[model samples]
Target: MTDLHTHILPFTDDGATDFDDALDMAEMAAENGTEIIAATPHFNIPGIQSRSVSEIKDTFEQMKNKIEKNKIDISFVLGMEIFASPTVGEKLDCGELITLNGTRYPLIEFGFSEKKDFIFSVMDDLISRSYTPILAHPERYDCFISDLQSLYELYQMGVVIQINKGSILGRFGRRVQRTADAILCHRLAAVAASDAHSPITRTPDLSEFVRVLDMNYGDGCSPLLLEENPKRILRNEDVFWESPIPFDYQR
Candidate 1:
């Protein structure tokens, strides 16, 4: 499986602290059947510190070398979990921020709070510049969780929704877990990612979550969420999405 969002890069953001933690994270990822991983560290948050592109690349290379030396069979790709901000367009134009597969698709995130008009405007700005924006873990957004119609509107506005694996399995919290279910039931989420941080507490793993999806939805649903959709993002190809599952708010 290919995991599109992860924090395995060492000494970057709130992920692994050093090389040892990184290797351990890789081992956990490998054990979970992740063949390719995109090392997406947090970038451009208001107070959260992160590594620059050059610095993140260096750390990724170091991890690659270590993996090669240890004979670990996992491929790593470079990406950034960009926080939605006013300067996002400028950053992309100046080549300061990295997009998925160096293409027009960017994985953007917002804090778990109320929504505002500017957030949608930023997404519009990206689309106006011919960039496809994928909202990371949209199920975790406090504002969208209670209002499926708003998320549907965003989907109509050309935003792809990504659900965190932890959220799917209720690892984040009950509220997030409920929203994650709603996303799946409504076919609102187009992709699923590990969003792993470390080896232990926030380790990089996808097996358990995949199992849950398969058990609840069916075998085909797992690949659609975990593999096929993610591959489209990595290749910058247009996504062929499934129809939204009707909202079952009774749950």
Candidate 2:
């Protein structure tokens, strides 16, 4: 399995505190059947400036060397979970931020209570610039959770949806868990990631979620979300997405 979203780079953001912690996260991921992981630290949030692109690359090189030295069998790639901002396109153009694995698909997160119009505007801008924006953990956003129609509209706008495994496992909260299930049942979620922040809490592990998805949604579901789609993102290929069944608010 490939974990598309994770903050395993030490001292980059609110993820691993040090190199040891990052290595531990990688080992845990390898133990849990994850072979590839994208280390996506937070980027461009107000009052929080993560490592620059060059800096992150340097850190990734150091981490890779350590992984090789330690014989940890996990592939690591560089990515950033960019917060939605008006200058996002400019940043991308100027090489201030990076997309997933150097592909056009960028993992984007919006404010928790951002308006639907604002969210759409940002997504539209990114799309207009020929960038595919992957919405990170849409089920956790209040606006989408309250009115799932907004999420469906975003999906229609060419925004790929990624849900957290913890959300599916009800680790975040009950509402997020229900929303994750609803999105999965509706076939709207295109990817599943750990979105893990640390080695202990929110660790990088997808085996349990894979088991649950297979038991409930059939064995095919896990491979599609955990492997095929994420690999597509890494290769900059268009994802094979099913037409989402519109979410029923009455449920």
Candidate 3:
């Protein structure tokens, strides 16, 4: 399996505290059947300025060395959970943004306020520059939870959607869980990720995600979200997806 969203880079943001924490997360990820992970640290959030892409590359290398030293087999890729700001475009233009697996697919986040008007505009700005924006954990967004149709609209506009694994397992609560189920039912989510931060609270494990998906959506559905789609994204290939029919079919 492949994990496309992770906060495993040490000291880059609010993720791992040091190198040891990174190693622990990597080990946990490997045990959970993950072979590749995109180390997406927090970047450009309110009052937080994380490491630049070049610095992230350095951190990734250091983490890779640590993994090798420990004999843990897991591949690391570069990415960032870009907290959307008014200066997002400027940041992307100035090399502050990190794309997942170094492709056009950039993972982005938003504030909790009613920035509905600005959502698509920001996505459009990125799109105009040849970037395909993937809204990170849209199910957790308050605005999206209140207005579920907006998510469908965004998906229709060619924006990829990633649903958090914990949300599906009810780790986030009812609103997020409801939105997550709706997303799965509609085939709105292209990938499922463990937006993991630590070994305990936000551990980098995909096992529960796989279990819940299989139990709820069927055993075959888990691979499409947890494995195949993430693999395709890393290869910079188009995710082969079929919209679920209203008649309760996988299309």
lDDT, model 2, position 214: 84
Tens digit of per-residue lDDT, candidate 3, span 182-245:
8888778888899999877778888878888889887767788878988888888887665743
Runs with alpha carbons beyond 4 Å of true place in candidate 1: 245-251
Model 3's alpha-carbon lDDT is 0.83
Tens digit per residue, CA lDDT, model 2, 1-251: 99999999987888999999999999999999999999999999988756678889999999999988999999999899999899898898788989999999999998888888888888999999999999999999988888887788888888999999899999988999998988898888899999999988998978889998889777888999999999999999998788898866643
Score candidate 3 by TM-score against the native.
0.93
Query: What are the TM-scores, per candidate, against the unseen true structure?
Result: 0.94, 0.97, 0.93
**Tens-digit lDDT string for candidate 1 (117-164):** 766888888888888898899888877777777787788788888888
Ranking by lDDT: 2, 1, 3
Alpha carbon deviation, residue 65, candidate 3 (Å): 0.9
Q: What is the lDDT of residue 145 in candidate 3?
A: 81
Task: Report, for every candidate in turn, its global Cα lDDT versus the true structure.
Answer: 0.83, 0.90, 0.83
lDDT of 3 at 196: 92
User: Order of candidates by TM-score, top first?
Assistant: 2, 1, 3
